[model samples]
Target chain A: MNELEKRLLDGFQRGFPLTERPFAEIARQLNAEEDQVIGALEGLSESGIISRVGAAFAPGGIGASTLAALAAPPERLEEIAELVNGFEEVNHNYEREHRLNLWFVITAPDRDGVDRVIAEISRRSGLEVLDLPMLESYRLNLGFDLQWS
Target chain B: MNGIPAIDHMDRQIVLATQEGLPLTARPYHAVAKRVGLEPQEVIVRMRRLLDQGVIRRIGVIPNHYALGYLGNGMAVWDVADESVLEMGRMIGDLDYVSHCYLRPRFPPEWPYNLFAMVHGHDRGQVLERVDKINAVMDEDARAHDVLFSTRILKKTGLRLPT
Candidate 1:
């Protein structure tokens, strides 16, 4: 990516604007036309530079989100991934290289519901649910420049 | 995502309009556009600019922590050996269980843990066990680390532009 693309990513991640003509405003700032700005973003999303274009909320603020994992064998990895991602409560899931194996975050309507969901998963998958809830938050910021030097 | 340009008031309106959650209905962008008093395409155009510039990282659902029953959540830091951290970090992050994992600059005197990952479990025991599993994958004499769990959630918002 060129310097301009890198700069745009940095600005988006750092401080996103909220406005009616937000793109037009951004175009004015970047000295680009609104159409150009829109087109570039479409291209960016198409190029897999970003996953999506929307809001990211804190799970607990509205409901509850937990970090849950299962020790799925190699044979059942795909099956497990499908099962875990099936639930509406399950938002993000990934494969980590740990003994625990499959790792996923479950978001629910309430904190108590997390336990029920885990129990249901445990029953279906027959995998022990190791639940780790957040006890304290020292530094919770996850914003970083995509092209930080 | 890369980076977006520093935004202005107009951009702030667009962001605020879509901040809470995008309507799941058809033409979700239309509602956002109407609220902002701009054409749907114009709103789309502006959203594109923000995405192009990396103004918005992603538009997705953020799990509710309290509702999830993951009462225990914390930033678990590890004192990983330099050689293994790069691989270890990726491995840990790859886990479907771990929501986030990354290497952060650690201060010697103040912050001892350079590698940080957010671990969420139903309880402290489960969280510790998960940490233990991650630790077992590391070198025997790897640097020590600690977990800074959140006792109370002060504030939780994705990204806020200067209004």
Candidate 2:
């Protein structure tokens, strides 16, 4: 990574200016041209380094969300996973190595919606659903320092 | 300003406008304000207030760890004692490798893990090393634990509010 890209990744994790010209503000801070800053950010996003430049809503604030899991038979794991992922409410689904392996996050517009999705997944997969909703968030920040090694 | 406070219509509009992502342009907020039919300054003020009120956790770049070569992401679940879970959670959350640490409910007889800590690394070995370190820190308080490595991303997207 070039110096400009490094700086952009390192610096813009937080405190992105809320202004008419945010790229310009970033440019001023980085001592680079406005277009160059925009270009670098575009490249980063294109390269999939950054998912998006936006607001991360507090969990369970605007919508109801819960971490749910299911133990799918190894032979049918892929089928069940695809079934669970079929729901639009299921945003993140993963296959883990455990008895209760098929874990996913169900995000819906409301508490009732979350319940509905869970019930649907359980019915479709014919497996017990373990709805482990977060009681308290000790830390939720995911940003980390980009080590240039 | 510290808890999940109620949001007004305008606040809802702002969230709906920027939930997917902020526009990648020189004037991103201006684009958002235009979409939400609010002035640029007003949008900024509302966003600041939202941040303070804990509605919006942050306004910044959200990176994809997998794409960044931190391929081995483990969701380490621990079966810690109820009394020590909170304290241990705080300590685990303080670790640089641990990105997300939360107190979640546990289903007994089948699922005994209550605490969830997400650790990431470039490979499975690195992730396991971090998990070992976390286990060392927890000591005997963590009765049992398991690492759940995500094999596939069935679906991944930001939470969407009812518009």
**Candidate that would win on lDDT:** 2
List, residue by residue over B34-81, the lDDT tens digit for candidate 1: 898888888777766665554544443233444446656656778776
Off by over 4 Å in 1: A140-142, B1-30, B33-163
DockQ of each: 0.05, 0.68
Off by more than 4 A, model 2: A140-142
* TM-score on alpha carbons, each prediction: 0.54, 0.94
Taking all chains together, the TM-score of candidate 1 against the true structure is: 0.54
Question: What 10-residue stretch in candidate 2 chain B is worst by lDDT?
Answer: B154-163
The TM-score obtained for chain B of candidate 2 when compared with the true chain B: 0.95
Error of 1 at A111 (Å): 1.4
What is the C-alpha local distance difference test score of each model? 0.60, 0.84
lDDT of 2 by residue, A1-149 (tens): 57887898788888888777888998899899999988887888889888888888888777778999888989998899889877877877877777877888887767899999888888887889989888888886746766666
Give i-RMS (Å) per prediction. Answer: 12.7, 1.9
- Model 1 docking category: incorrect
